[model samples]
Target: MGMGVMRIPRSAFIWISLFFITLILANYGKLVADAISMNWLVKYPKVWVFPLKDYVSLAMQWLVEDATFGLFTFTEATRGLSWVIEQPYNFVRALLSEGFERGLGKSAVQVLPPLSWLTVLSAVIALGHYAKDWTLAAIVGACFGYLAIFGQWDSAMITLASVVIAVPIGVGGGLLFGILAYRHHWFGRLLKPALDLMQTIPIFAYLVPILFMFGFGPVSALVATVIYAMPPMVRITTMALQSVDPEITDFGLICGCTQSQMTWRILIPSALGSLMVGVNQVIMLSLNMVIIASMIGAGGLGFDVLASLRRLDIGGGFEAGIAIVIMAIAIDRLSQAFAERSTSYVHPKIRNRIYHRHPRSMIVLTVLIFSMVVGFFIPMYQHYPESHTITTGAFWDDSIKYLNINYFDQFEAVKIFFLKSFMLPTKRFFIGIPWPWMTCLLVFIGWTFGGWKLALMNGLMTLFIVTNGMWAKAMITVYLCGVSVVIASVIGIPLGILAAVNKRAGKIIGAVIDTLQTLPSFVYLIPVVMLFRIGDFTAMIAIVLYALAPAVRYAAHGIRSVSSELIEAGIVSGCTPTQILTQIRLPLALPNILLGINQTIMLALSMLVITALVGTRDLGQEVYIALTRADTGHGIIAGLSIAFIAIIADRVISASAKNARIRYGLETTHGH
Candidate 1:
């Protein structure tokens, strides 16, 4: 399609064919070895001829021997860390115990009573009702009630606690780093690349290094979750703070405000809107990590979902999924309300009375009464002397056993059929193509769409995959992720446009998008795999389900953000609502819709690393294998390759989006 590319003769196909033939002949033995290596028969024979069992045992022995030595080395190095934390833990313990007799009235080692289920539900309903309107109140109440009834209340509470801890830490760290990045030119420059790497690294990659350093538990999970969730907030905060009006700063200076006061009172308050968006992002991402974090011993709904997945228990997984969704919705709405609350108009007279009313006293009085009632009445809420109180033992274990016995019986047949008919056939079709032929096709398509930059990127990415001996696996991954993205955009765009056109419907859809975007991917993966089985189709469905949210959100935002004057012009021209939407609105919102497509691609890529839970032979599978075997070299290379693909796509889409935005005179970034 390009002038330079068009001049090349199609007759070069003969030379291309011959070149591949010669290359294949030259590397026939290597190719045969690789093919044989990957074969289930050659790599894992039935204990004979190859002595597969003996070989596997020997490999396991080698791995365990190395792992034991590594552990011993680490233990020696960190021997003092245990002592350091013990000193602090003991110091606080002694102080609390000493003060207990002097009316502090608390023992450091003793467990306190938890609020009753009824009390907790009542408080949540009250808070939700107070936050927004009656609809929100009902949604909040129903969500928690369902969680409680489904036997996920305790795990849900643990997840809530972790989120509560992580969010504030993420927010604080983000704000600090944001201010640092904003104030120092060199620091910001250094931070940009680090942020890029952090943003693109797979969640599993974080697990290895984190577990290496912090070991596996809630703390390591917290560390990983915070790292992942904090970046967007940092970037947003820096951008928002940098975008603050110069005149406002001058005015604040003239008002006799110190630099610190100006930052606290003027800049931060003025930038609150965008900052709140960052906060919302943090909360949502934290919730997304809940299930992934479970891999590292962060117990909650995430663990339950994982357990259900391993056992193929679709119903149990569905329940946990619902709990995750409910939590996501509640937290998202709360953040949204907080962001909106600052803008609410307060009557001057009522504001003064409300401010003078000593709200803390009322809060303290309510807490005391609630505590008294809960401590006295609820059996399960009282501090238990033994292991049994409220329990979910049979509910979880029986579900797993039932599914293992009966559920996968029918599904396995279908899975085998699909694998034989569709999956294997498609894979062979792609792998049968000569590399040179594939290269030409890629170059031609890339040139047609995005021109030379894309062509160059395509060439480089293809070369990388081929050199790494993963070209076929990469193609399979591309096919699945591509299909998912296309499907998401198909559904999400029109739905978003429709939502944007109606105020009430926009509210309802907006809530759905919020919930979907935040719920953990593993929650969706189980039933998807159960329904479709563990192959490309199930993975694509899972990715599509999550990827659709960004597409819907951006399309809605783009349509709603369109200038009203354009609509009026269309109306004056005697255009119907349908004509306006088709002719005026869509054309105007094209750039933003393209942005939504970009987001869909990124979201789909994120899911690539996750779909490995259902087992794909993609880069994600390699990454997982590397973690299990502690093969850091292979893992890093595979991880970077995935990141390279993402970066290429991200750069192309972002460039195109920027071009469209500039052409349409649209603002690229929003300020507070």
Candidate 2:
């Protein structure tokens, strides 16, 4: 008698209605499109397409050829900037890997060696131990030792030289901008979306314009690397600075500090630990771009890997990839340890004497000088002799040969099974969706998740893709990324649950995921390309390997984050372990799990540009092709399509997660 009508929130009602209407209209519109000969609705027609990419190209051209400042044309200005950037790169390279020459012109001869391997190794080990403990020092030492022992020392140092130059620049620039944003609300408002867009745009897309401005050389590569690696640092710095305790801020003000003094003396010092996290991120991301940077003449180990990949030299690629991984692990762990040191170190004023203030630095300097002196007398110490170096290149190649010889049928079967069952079907379905219908559906989803603002954003972005005649390729990119993410989540979520519930499992899985996360995107492609040959399947595997860690991490964190009281209540209710997980834990953890999915999607798209090398024809390929042709328009447009897809998915899923968190009383947000 009391069930006349049920009340629903305005949001719930609109979304519910929008969902059904979108579904019906999207599907029915396809049939209508076919009847009306409206092929534009199915595939964006070239004749009617917008020339966004062309517009972008024209602007870039003007900058390169016509724009000027003061006495210099834009080209001259850019060349000057490039020259300035190269000075540091050259100095570092000379110090670490190339060494110096005496005399001038053709009469020059080798006058000094690059820092001896032993010296650099000693420096790294001492710094590691001083930063943390012997455990970390040992790890760092072994990573460096491997490079020398395996004949990668020379190339590795070249890579290191570039990273050394790039990290400081990236971290410094990001911090400066981040502080400006934090100090000015209006600036922060303007900066937030710019950072988002910068992060979303693939590194390859920017390289086109950068290559145009700076010309092909290490300077351009360094510039691209800095741009690619800086966004996270900026975001992190703003967050960390803001998170500083208010009491600390008040103390500095009470001490009659100026605004600058309160900031540098108080807020920044208190936020040092978190700022170190940004530094660590910058280090890792800079390393991740090593291979990508190589394309623009940043030559080093990245060039080695790239050459090997192009030639299908599995052994060569594997060896270089391992070297990259080792370098990354050493740098990553050392940076993390430094972050810890930042947390624990006493203030400079608290320490007396230079030795006490920088004991590690003194030790390193002492070892460095001694090594160089001894190395001058002993050529073996100055340079690793070719005869003494060991290599695993042939071994890796042989192993691949063995696998192919022994398991060719099995490998083929697995690839075919996944392609036939999951991959192709998803690809066909996504590509088959009418562009207009897909656009409408996404707009509805955005509205359902995040109200009109998100809906408008989604609609406009989707339309841009459609009107630019990129719908087919964009959908192909979507399907590849979508399938890869689905696969990663399927593999990662379960392991995450097991890890959450069992300590031993958690330890083992955590170790594995940590290693996976440490490997750069390029490294993932080496073995995958070796076993599977060049195709979408290989790309999918590589994407999965790259994306899996986040899914596992987030899912485990979510499940473990569930309140202990809830678990106890379930036990008190006589619930089974599985039942508690299936009901209470899973429901409460849905928001976190959704966020994990969002991350997985982001990672999958990031892999797209790298995976393009394996012969996939997604937007990544578009970017790569555009890069080669120096076609800024094509690259930027394609990159925008990919970025828009990722950003839209991120916004919708984030909104959904926020709603779920609020419903569970885990958040108290009152605004969208």
Candidate 3:
């Protein structure tokens, strides 16, 4: 038998494909819907199902029972570890915000004196001065003062205590892992995928296992934050250490330096700049995860935001959100300023200045003494007066009400158009595809972009989703992420280009991007829900806003990173600005732009779990439902599905970037 096919133009083929899909959906819509809605087709057969949830529950029950029966001392071990971890957190928290408490019994406990709020404020100011300059000191003082004035001082301090505990753990573990990966080829290969998985997985995913193992509280939250924040630290550390000049290592060896001495004295000092960037990343990630951590009983400003959202108290939520933003800005600026200062060369004269000559210890001591004396005389120095506290919650609440009432029709129109015209159809198309066909399509694209390895990886991931009975939900997730990314790119790329070409525009746009990036991802849902109401569109809007920063940032970075020599060459060749950008800049920037796209997808996926609260029937909703119901099996699987999708994209995009670099002769022996 002979098979023959008619040739079709590329455009015609695309049109024909769309027509075929529409026809199938129209004709067999109910059947397709039923197949997706029913579990039998996608779910594992009863015999094949593993019952992981029951196993985990049973194991936990047995462990607890054993501990209680003294058959094992699991509880004692956990208690000891918990106590060790809690001590520093509690101490710092009390000093900064809680104030010390001492008593004979719970009912009779009396608050004892602790370090004054003014002392804490002065210490921050001093640290800021030591880290950067007087400007940063002012910023730090102002940020802390705002918290005290807004009556969020305690909540902010609780959050800060967690951060202080978590960042060091994250940075330390990351450095260890990074060094190991850098030293051993096999370990590096093994570590890369794990880091990618960790980085791409949503923070919420980390909370489930932590909650189960540690139970719910600040300890669990700290563990989750560390896990969530560590990958970047590791990747950055490895890259920084690996990027050190070979000549420097040879010189250290020639000087008879041992490995430990070389690492401590030479390697660390030389790589300090890159490592500082990693530190900044760790700090930011820890802050960002604080809110998600709150969901699992980690109380702080994050809890403030979460509680407000639950109560639909927009004013309160906004205030808490502002407090968070202020804290983020303070930390970010201080870290960045310090990083920059460390890399800079200071004049000897300036370095010898009285304040500069002394170590940070002297400055800290001076501030502490002053604060103590002031606190002894002034009661308000110990704590901001409650009567003097200010709030903007009411203003925010009123503003939101006014906007919702005044713009109801406009919001409704946008919601309806987006849902009917873009979201639903795209979602339907993805969900309607046969599981086998979807798997084949993914494999084909992966192979085309990255060869057999990626194809196999993606195929396995797709299989996992299909067998887990989450294909439909995964499709919905894909639809939401895909739409959000497309819209973000549409808005972000052009702005990035504009920013890249103009210095003034870059500064202005960079500030906006920074604000957006630092704002808690959860805060994005509030304003969108206020306008669009609860639905996929609102969720998409939140995801887009949360995800847009990277798109704009990377695009601008990519464009700017293009060699100035190339731009000059274009100019010398009589190329117009448009022609130069199209013919030269964009080509060079494509790899970075693609990276931005990859990041946007990852961010969008991360936001998925949070957006679940706003009503979206996807894998995010599955995870959220599992969390609420304490169904570990379902949440873990659903979260893994999201991770799998992200991994697949990351692999393909990375492969493509590598190929592009090779083609452009920009590939290097060492890469981050």
Against the reference, the lDDT scores of all candidates come to 0.71, 0.89, 0.84
Model 3 residue 278 CA deviation (Å) reads: 1.0
Off by over 4 Å in 1: 1-111, 115-142, 255-259, 343-471, 497-515, 559-583, 664-672
lDDT per residue (tens digit) for residues 148-263 in model 3: 99999889988998999999999999999988888787999999888877877666655665676678889888888888999998999889998999999999999999988988
Model 1, CA-based lDDT = 0.71
Tens digit of per-residue lDDT, candidate 2, span 228-312: 8999899888998899988888888889999899878898889888999999889888888888999999999989988888888
Q: Provide the clash count, candidate 3.
A: 0
Best by TM-score: 2
lDDT score, candidate 3? 0.84
Model 1, span 1-672: residue lDDT tens: 656545546647755875666445334533564766744211222332223323434544444334345447444343344344334333433222211132334534433334445555666666665567677767787877766766777778778777877888899999988988888879999998678767776777657666655666777777889989999999998998998999998899999999679878988898998899999999989998988898887878899888888897766676787789888887788788778876565554444564355443445446546654665775444222234423454565566556656867676676677567756665554545555556666655466457897888777776665565555556666666666787799999988998999989888888888767766788778756656667676787788888999899889988988899989998999999999998878877887898899888878877887898787778788777766765555565566667666766676676667666766667443411
RMSD of 3: 4.6
Position 284, candidate 3: lDDT: 93
Comparing 2 with 3 on TM-score, the higher-scoring candidate is 2
Candidate of highest lDDT:
2
Q: Backbone clashes per model, in order?
A: 0, 0, 0
